[model samples]
Target chain A: MDRVGTVGIVGVGLIGATIGLALRQRAVAGQVVGVDIDAQAIAAAREIGALDAGGSDLDALRPADLVVVAVPPDDVVSTAVQAAAVMKRGSILTDVASTKAEIVRALDERLAGRVRYIGGHPMAGSEGRGARMADPALLSGRPFLLTPTDRTDPAAVSMMTEVAERLGMLPVLLSPDDHDDLVAQVSHLPYLMAVAVVGAATDRAIGIGGPAFAGLGRIARGPVELWVQICRSNRAAIRRSLGQFRRELDRLERALEGEEPLEILLQRSRRRAPVDGVPLDKPPR
Target chain B: MDRVGTVGIVGVGLIGATIGLALRQRAVAGQVVGVDIDAQAIAAAREIGALDAGGSDLDALRPADLVVVAVPPDDVVSTAVQAAAVMKRGSILTDVASTKAEIVRALDERLAGRVRYIGGHPMAGSEGRGARMADPALLSGRPFLLTPTDRTDPAAVSMMTEVAERLGMLPVLLSPDDHDDLVAQVSHLPYLMAVAVVGAATDRAIGIGGPAFAGLGRIARGPVELWVQICRSNRAAIRRSLGQFRRELDRLERALEGEEPLEILLQRSRRRAPVDGVPLDKPPR
Candidate 1:
């Protein structure tokens, strides 16, 4: 896919700006052009040297060899469909949205013949949002999961893998359904658990809190508008993961309440330790 | 209380080394001597200038106007009892153990009139431990909770506050029981939740794991032996907080499974926002 020349980046938000920065850092030969509904965001991308040029016009992106939709989750499908309608034939398109299954289905239904569309989710971000917090190094050493459907062309998948490798990310390939289930367990479920724990701490009867509470609760402060769309779109998987977490929580509660020996609780927690892969180390400063 | 000069610190581990460093920075009109069970730790503290003098002997702590016990949680009370027996009659004593009620109770029951013991828990630490990581700035702007029982000398509490203020930590007065409950909600409960989340993720059926899982799981990686002691000693409060968390998890489970709208989940999580306080913009790099 060396013929993949120009790269069109839709939405100059954190993810878009970061991808642009990463491309520039690696000196990827393709011309990186940005498209954003926000004129100010386009300007900010230019100021950060993340784009050769960017504007509010979608037509400016039509000639690109590769198109990346980095809009919010709710906008991913619609944006891809709109961009697909105007794209040059054989040009590939992909998204960096959190959830994949729905977006993959939407792209399949709307943009099947217009361009090869792949779903991508980079498991990296700062608590802060927008262009200011965008770092080229943000995706370094992070997993960049790609969900390619049966309809996706093999060359398109390889082309996206090339970009992910250029960004210093480890690319993992999976089917759309597999990707959704995996993230439901890792990303989405943990977020819900964080929200629940935060809710419990804020209960009036408890009046319980400390720095640790704050640290654990910090995950709940994400933009609600964005998360709402994600949860609604991936309801089935999210619900399943939530059920799994609840069962574990119940097990812990029963252990705490029962006069079970402390060794049992310790053993239970220890047995579950291998899930994290790496040895539990102190939180990074 | 100006007469309370020359503070001696025993067990120059993370807490002890940090206290010595903070005292040195504040120049609190007192000499700071450090003692540790590990000769290497004592030598390390001396090399870093975290102590005016260092040795492995408890006798080296005898000349101090006040003594600070900063050992692991398990050794807190035993060390305090020993310090009380050896420290001069008018000398004050304090500790930086996470759990306050137990240590305060131990001091009250074991060393009633021998020394003025006030318990303090500074809510600050880096993942880095020992003298090499010691920084006077560690406690700045962090909360330093003081749990002084009625039997403890008011003068000792004031002295502890003076030190906290000098180090730039906000001195918060709390009853031992209240402090324990607060920390359980804040610290212990979060640690337990992290462990549980990590454990749940480890289940073989799910097979989904990555750095995000590892990042969230890092809280469980703290010295397990330390946590074992902490969980065992603070069992009552930790168990209660965990129960409260479990109830919230049950509610979330029901909501996710039942016909609750997506907005309801968002609203529930938003209401719990205060549990996190202000977002930690970014940790110190």
Candidate 2:
């Protein structure tokens, strides 16, 4: 693949640095430029060979064909808008945030006609934060969700998809609302459940917990502040998902009084089918 | 380790076969014999080199120094009693059941004054069932819970501990009630939570689930029939655990209205400690 012109990445944190490293290593970008408020992050990214050029200014993105806002979920919209203001006209702009609906809506409204803004969320991360922990292979084979509105440019979507593939990611398209709701159920809700499992564990229970118990509590070990932001950002969908979860828990609790009911509930729970009506027996990808 | 003479396994299923294989492969046993009502299972165990000798009769345990009832939870009690009756006096009898209170209580009463009954639960398993999937290394470094009542012989516990070590297990001693309660919170509750997660997931939610969601749902993919038996066998403890989990969920839901409360709850949830007052940062052992 011919090197795409300069790629500007905002934040220069884990995701941004990883994108830089992957793009540079794979020769997908002619120059991988990074900008961050934290000068230390920029230095770290440069030291790790994740950046060809780096700075703390938006002007650094002016010559880039693609600009990626890789900030936290709460900062993605503002950062994308600021980067878009400096990006050359017709150049594509995208983001790597977990939640999408609010960020995409904000960016589409604020950066309209300035740059082609498309929402991208690489479904990958590590427990450790910052550029030091960024790995080029982190996003490989993981789902790269692109939340594109009908108003989004087809050219922009195609560009982002190519970049995602170059980074060894599997690009999947969804609406911003769909993306938020899907993650609320799968990602956000499961994180909360893990937190609940850990919070509710009795001292006695902790004493004798084997691998299964430990496994359930594993996902809860992520940073609390980040998860708190995620939960707050996608509250409605998470609440709805939480309600659905409560219903299932209630069903199991009610069925506990009788052997047959419990057995039937478990049997029903075992049936798993994909959205395309495919029976799925394999572990989740 | 001196070779343990004539280790007899009552059920040549996954756990039983794994035990047989590990014992024989490590030369921990002088001879490994297996008995299964299912002739096919017996053949499979023999074919896998899991047993030196095999049969469909309890009399196969007549010369055994130790008999492990490696049957399903529902059948553990009856199988243990039967095996005890067939074995000569002073031979140790143990079981490999997920839930222990009921099985241990039944065997302690029935096999008293005959064979020394020590309840053993090796906390290792695979989603795959039967002798064909038996793996000797499956139990390596996994917890081996020993639930011994006052009536249980010290010698029997020591012998089971020695055997568990030979199988590469870390033996943990807990009372029968404690064992049931601990698993109810950890194993059984987590399994139920995984089921609830699967049951509650919308089609669209599943479509976009990343690794976190997949990891949470992985534990639920085990055989439903087996889990039903486990849930039924430890109903009271499981119900209590479910209540604790529900209370935590309720707290989270109620706190959802305010950021500070939710943040506080998550912060508290992040604190993990072992029973010995150790700040545990490690995954469950």
Candidate 3:
């Protein structure tokens, strides 16, 4: 909770680099250190000034008041555990992985009381991956969710919230299970939908696609390795969302095949309409 | 063939009024005429200067050198037939309906060489509908598809192409069936996907949706009556695309559940990379 003296960032990927840039702009820390197992990535982080110093050593994070694990979803658990083991006692530790329930469960099972660990997931991400696409502006005005259970340190959560605010993100609190279910319905489901649409298409179909088609399938091009882990880790919730979507799609298909009442089918959208109490059936005059 | 002595637009809804505005800007016609079954729609179109003259009768389009029908899918065939009966022979006629084959068949069966009729579809529409949302710039820089079979008039196709270009649109040639199949995969299927996703979602889930969720579900808000008609008219093609998508989703789901090699699944995206063929595994250095 002390205005963090030093911030150590492990895995200088897009989220990591963007976070590093934000920390630097706010001068919230006396020094920033970036660590990566990929030696060349450490060099890239240093060249871009995403760190005051960079190296392939975990020991460098020992002095940092806050350590952020921004590694891939597959590596998040082990890397977060490693950061906890090396960093100073009472120093806050957090991660920016998308899927939360399992990671928070894994961390809570391993690192609680040893190191202050609060899980975070930022909602902003670009279609383009890696540090080259990272920007300080990327995190601007975005939402970040913090999953803290009864076991989490209260002061660590407050410090993490302050850091998220300085990065220009609004912080919301949720339980890890709730976070996964909510994101599965919104974020994870959309990516799977895009992948399904694009995978079923041919080049001829893509050639004719404009803004609507492109926007709808944009995230299907995300790195396969990353998405595989994300989808697998959160399989149950994703499957539930997909099951609901299939039933909804069947309803629409049946309606297309028969003289179904469209007004009844569109009843939900009407309730969410931004318009005044005007009936959609009555076109503007 | 002719420089459109008088351009007539039927329907006076969003597409119809937008066409009137474009024709007026180019001065391609001696005068632009607007006609609609709804009397108030004509008043709205004229009030916006989208029409030089407007009326509620089909006969008001009698003096036109060309007529553009932009009504709903259910009304397109009958409206085109009515316009053909009233407008003079050799006066080119086209309908801007999303689905083409049925309407083109309806025109060929009824008006063959009696009046030149071509099918056109502009790849531009807003979530907002009607004359109040109409803009002269709406059709600018959009793609317009002209679907023609062997029986279609060459001069009518040329005139429609010229009109599309004047409105700053690119005109592409497509067979009616080909157009339907392509749009089914890229456009119609995406819309249905959005509807299914949004329709199945709870308000809590939508509250946390980011860009991917919002953009993917954006078009689900299109008017219910129009979308119901669109889905029904093109049911066969849409069903085919949806079937393909479901199969594709099953494959990805199995991959997430099993120890499948993600690289093989992601091969197409790597080939289509905007990056320098750097393996996504190798984080940027």
Best of the candidates, TM-score: 2
Winner on TM-score (1 vs 3): 1
* Model 2, C-alpha of A4: deviation from truth (Å): 2.6
Query: Which portions of model 2 show Cα errors greater than 4 Å?
Result: A1-3, A132-137, A273-285, B273-279, B282-285
For model 3, chain A alone compared with the true chain A gives a TM-score of 0.90
Per-candidate chain B TM: 0.90, 0.92, 0.90
Give the least accurate 10-residue stretch of model 3 chain A, judged by summed lDDT.
A273-282
Among all windows of ten consecutive residues in candidate 1 chain B, which has the lowest summed lDDT? B276-285
Off by over 4 Å in 3: A26-31, A37-53, A259-263, A267-285, B24-30, B37-50, B55-57, B135-141, B259-263, B266-285
Give per-residue CA lDDT, model 3, range A84-135, as digits (tens).
8888888889999889999999998899767899999988788766666668
Q: Alpha-carbon interface RMSD of model 3?
A: 5.8
Summarize candidate 3's per-residue lDDT along B1-285 as a digit string, tens digits.
445789899999988999898888777777999999888899999998899998888998889889999999899888888888888888888888888777787887787867888898987787668897898776777679899788888988889899888888889899998888888887888877877777777666666667677675556666777877777788889888888988877877776667575456555543332231122232222
Number of clashing pairs, model 3? Answer: 0
Q: Model 3 Cα displacement at B246 (Å)? A: 1.9
Rank by lDDT, descending? Answer: 2, 3, 1
Binned by DockQ into CAPRI classes (incorrect, acceptable, medium, high), candidate 2 is acceptable
Native contact fraction of candidate 1? 0.36
